[model samples]
Target: MASKVCVFTGSRSDFDRLYWICLEIQKTEGLELQLIAGNMHLSPEYGLTINAIRETGLHVDAEVDMLVSSATSVGTAKTVGLGTLSLAETFNRLQPDIILVLGDRFELLSVASACTCMTIPMAHIGGGQTTEGAMDEQIRHMVTKASHLHFVANEMFGQRLKNMGEEVWRVFITGSPSIDSLMRTPKITTEDLSKELGLDLARPTALVAYHPATLDPLNLEAHTNQFIEALSQFEGQLVLTYPNGDPGSEYIIKSFQKLDAAHGDRSVLIPTLGITRFVSALLHVDFMIGNSSSALIEAPTFNLPAVNVGDRQKGRLASSNVISCAQDSASILRAMQEAMALGKSPCGKPYGDGKASPSIVSALKSTLEKRTRQQLLTKKFSIPGEDK
Candidate 1:
């Protein structure tokens, strides 16, 4: 019988990050694919991105309701509780040989918890990455402890996982599968893309993808006003990607939409952009302004310049090609000017080889057979100066 591997994607953000791995698992012989969609993918508020997965010719194994529609932290906690219950039912029914989880989304915590209780080994990607501002920092480490196999985005991350006492042999530095899509993505002619969106291709363009700073107490409207005020000074077209479904997103989206409408040709609001279009836009745009992690990790690969504002993406991996600044209008404007100057400066891809999918699939096929699922299920703690 084929080994069943279940993969979980909670939102468009995480799915985009895991796109290549899902495709690779589908192509691997003797590996059955199961896609469990949940959270923002199921909500119209986030564009129902589960359809995007289906458009790729993949089937949804199970639809899990793991998101709290509200933005409060209390709502988030309740969502986790609900996710654990729903995911427990799903895993008990499927009983897959392994679970595939990516990144540090809270929904993933529930998945890992359910699979751990069912004695199913999980293979976690992006396990050791760090973005200090949000709850993801703690959640990523927790997932790493729960996972049996680790496919980290970079060597530094891989070593971080190993230092956490995970077996070295079980960890693979497979880079980031998300970067693989950039390699296969067809070039998108600016004229065609602009025609598709009815945008003027000749205008100087900036792509903005800011998200909420969980640590910031100011209202979303207040924060967005500063960014919008700064953008009003620019003489170019602005392509704004809506923020992730965090506490302050609704307000941010409202502010961005209102501003975009007022600016007319000067701005456009895009709910979401496909991987191809996003990377393509990065290639053609004069500069990127955002706090989205992609601006730091993926854009630099295309030699794209980014104007990263605020603490949402603070302490995350980035290239010198990115200019960081405070949230005020003057600071943001200065950063954008610098970013426009830096333009596309050649920088090493901070994530990994575009071959991450193949390496990850190879590791799973070879390592799964030899791994001790029972040993993985049994949690052991180490004392000082003691070796396992």
Candidate 2:
């Protein structure tokens, strides 16, 4: 009998990262794939990305709506609580043999907690990564503890997972599935992008995908204002995407809207670009300006220069193409200028070689086949410097 693999995607970004994995699981003969769409995907404010999932023809087995409209810390906590309750019911119905989750979104953490209580073994991806500027750092580690299987983007992450006492046999370095999307997804031409996005790609352009720094203690509006001021210094067209559904996202959205209004045709603010369009934008844009993880993970594949502003992505592994800058307008402008001047160059990406999906599928198949349910639920912490 086929092993039932249930995958949970809470946001469009998470879905993009998991797209190829879902496809691979669906094609594998001994694996039955079940997808649960929740969080930002169901939120009307987040571009209704569930439609994007539907358009892909991947059948969504369940829909979990647990996003709170409020964009505050309290609201985010409540949303997590609500998601836990809602997912508990969903899991009760599906009763999947194994659950797969990726990234460190709070909603994903909620699902992890529910899965832990239900004694459902979880396969976690993107564990052992560090994003110190937000609360995701702690959440990522917490999810790592709950997960039975760890699939990381790089060897360093795999090592970190081991340091956290995860059994060596269960942790695998599968690279990033996002890199697979970058290498395999059909490229959209510049002309096609011009027609679809109504922006002339012939001239210099920068793709900005800034997200709010959840750890910033002061006024997030001030930080966003500085970012917008810096972008105003750019000489060419700016294609800015909306922030994620974090606490300070609403403020960033308003700032982007204001910038878009003032800049007119020079700037375009899109709520979501999906994976293909985003990868295409990376190909054509002269430089990327933002603190988005994509700037570090996916932009390197295109040999694109990314001016990563602020500390949101401070501790993540980056290639030569990435230039870090402070949140202030002057610092961001200087970094952007440097990135624009540097232009594109040959670069070595630390992420995988565009073959993460198959390896992940193989690992899932073998792990599920060999490990019993009781073994999957039980974990023994491996102390550092001690032989397994």
Candidate 3:
């Protein structure tokens, strides 16, 4: 009998990260793939990205309606509550053997919590990563504790999972599936992407994908002001995409609109760029700007220069292509200069080679075939140097 593998994708952001893994599962001989999408994917305000998922060859088994259209932290919490209620039922109906979850979104918190309560063994990808500037840092670790199988992007992350009391045999360093998705997904030529987004590829270009700092959104407007001040002077053809669904995304979206409203032809705001288009943008753009993790994990694969704004991505591993900056205009301008200077040069990317999908699929199948649910759920915490 095929092992049932259900993948939960809450937004456009994590969906891309999980794409290849889903496809790999669907193709493998003994793995049945199931997909459940919710949150920003179902919201028109977030570009109704569920349609994009439908366009993908893989089928979406279910859609959960859990996103509250509030731009405050309270709404985020309520979304979690709703998600747990809905996902509990969803899990009951599908009853997948293992749930594959990626990243550290608030929606994922609900998914993890519900999975834990239901006694479903979870395979968590992107665990053990830290972005201390946001609450995701804590949530990622929490998901780590809840999950039974850990698929990380690097040995460092696998070790971190081990440090968190995860048994060593349960951790697999499968790297990141970003490169696999980017390489396998049908490419949109630079010209077609340019026409689709109404930006000229002939000129210097930068792709901006900023997200709100969930940890400190009190000064969101101030951050927006700083972003506006920096982009206002940029000479490149800018392709700015919508942010993740979080508190203060309204302010961040407004900042993008403000730039488009003022600059006209110089910049364009794309509410949603699906994974294919986004991967295209990564390839063609000379530089990237924003706090989105793709700037660190995926961009370096193309040797693209990325200006990481503020401390949102403070603690993640990065390559030389990433230039750090404060949200202030002066610092942004300085980092922009450095990013341009660095250009697209070959740099060592820590997120593994372009073959993470097979490794992840193999791990999923091997673990499931060898270990029973009760055995997988059993965990033993061990200190690194306790014996010594």
Candidate RMSDs in order: 2.0, 1.0, 1.3
When sorted by lDDT, best at the front, the candidate numbers are 2, 3, 1
Poorest 10 consecutive residues by lDDT, candidate 2: 211-220
Per residue, candidate 1 scores C-alpha lDDT tens digits across 1-388 of 6788898999887787677787888888889888899988988777888899888787898998778888767777888889999999998888888999888877888988887777888989887777776767889899989888889888888878777877777789888877887777787898888876667757779988988776664655676789889988887889888877767777788888888888976777888886777878888888889777888877877888888888777777788888889888999999988887787878877888688888998898887666566755555543324566
Candidate 2 off by > 4 Å: none
lDDT of candidates 1 onward, in order: 0.81, 0.91, 0.89
- Model 1 lDDT on a 0 to 1 scale: 0.81
CA RMSD (A), model 1: 2.0
Which regions in candidate 1 have their CA more than 4 angstroms from the true location? 218-221, 379-388
Query: What lDDT score is found at residue 209 in candidate 2?
Result: 92
Q: Relative to the unseen true structure, what is the C-alpha lDDT of residue 101 in candidate 2, on a scale of 0 to 100?
A: 92
Q: How much is the lDDT of residue 130 in candidate 3? A: 86
Residue 336, model 3: lDDT of 88
lDDT of 3 by residue, 1-388 (tens): 9999999999887888788888889889999998999998999998998998888777889999999998789999999999999999999999999999988888989999899999999989898788988988988998899999988999899888888878888999988887787778788898998889888887888898888988878767788788878888888878988888788988888778878998878788889888889888888988999899999999998999999998889999999889998889899988988988888999988998879889999988999999998999887786677762
Identify the superior model by lDDT, candidate 2 or candidate 3: 2
